[model samples]
Target: RPATVDYMSVDAEAAEVEIFRDFPFADFDISVISVEVQAHNYYELDTIFVTAGYAKLAVLGGDHVYAKLRRPLVPPQGAAEWQRTIARDFHAHAPARSEIGRSQ
Candidate 1:
């Protein structure tokens, strides 16, 4: 049951996620938990885009799997604002950068 689902750890899987740091995204104490309960399932973590920390994931499967963002999704926003938000996060907490570096 638990195996059917998956989670992205953020730092571990940054490159694969579609995000921007220029904007702003609030972080949650707990990671977004995605689940899978399908009777039968087949998936490859590599084939799919997943991050270890705060990245969005794309799982290959049917309704059997369910996903919930432990970190709530940001409210809708304009394109430029959204891009900045993603870029900011990516630049700051991206697996590559240090948390301190982002605040600047």
Candidate 2:
């Protein structure tokens, strides 16, 4: 099912409180950090492409995740394979674009 959806940001403090209160087990077992970085460009690609790129970096970056940068790749290559190579190369530098911003 697909429909137009409106999006909003949740208060991070409230979200944390709720998660801890309702799912205490989850909190103790988990560490979650959310970051909002600005990519001032339109991304017109499949969800798989978008998500795989981020996840690969998150896992490989080892610490500084959430992508201070992202790179675009064309297809016929496997997502995981490309992501591995990208994570290695990407770690050295931040995203270089026309303009970039970071939002908490």
Candidate 3:
């Protein structure tokens, strides 16, 4: 079995916490996690992830994005530049556009 998971997108239907509790994340390098969580359960999720050395990067609708930043929640240098790069990449590869127009 693959113990190292770099990214996990979990939509366990409110059983996310239960599922996560069983995994030994400390044994591997988990870079990003996107989990389905109820709005009311944000606090619970926050505590669990924070204790596990992750920072909540964003909360999109019912999903939350968490990343292990090696430190507290402060943004790293050139945060705006990173955001712009991400946005550009997302737009360049958007599904509505044709592959012929996408940058390599």
Candidate 4:
């Protein structure tokens, strides 16, 4: 029943995928998410987030994957313009390659 979560971090040991599956991605406005996953569960976790309209931002320390929502979240009145500006700036400054520790 949570409405908006700006960021979420999950380190659920072996239950990372399950926890992500249970999260209401469509019902809530989650801007960013990071999960600690084992090698066996990495694909499954990636699938869930990609299916939920998120794009992989980075893979940290091999096990932690970070993602951001593909689309912009609705902003409060008087903040929409500011949000758009920030988004533009972010995209401009974002890394050329999303993932880390990967051969270019």
Top-TM-score structure, candidate number: 3
Which is better, 2 or 3, measured by TM-score? 3
Candidate 2 whole-model C-alpha lDDT, 0 to 1: 0.34
Cα lDDT of candidate 4 equals 0.75
Candidate 4 TM-score over all chains jointly: 0.59
Better of 3 and 4 by TM-score: 3
TM-score of every candidate relative to the true structure: 0.23, 0.23, 0.60, 0.59
- How many residue pairs clash in all the candidates, one count each? 26, 0, 0, 0
Model 3 score (lDDT): 0.80
Q: Report the Cα lDDT for candidate 1.
A: 0.37
Residue runs of model 2 more than 4 Å from their true location after superposition: 12-76, 84-104
RMSD of 1: 14.7
Model 4 lDDT, residue 4, Cα: 82
- Per-residue lDDT of candidate 3, residues 78-101 (tens digit): 668778888999987777745657
Write one digit per residue (lDDT tens) for candidate 1, span 18-88: 33222122332333433342323223322131222234344544212223444424445755787898899
> In model 4, which regions exceed 4 Å deviation?
70-104
Give all candidates' CA lDDT scores.
0.37, 0.34, 0.80, 0.75
Worst 10 residues of 4 by lDDT: 69-78
Q: TM-score rank, highest first?
A: 3, 4, 1, 2
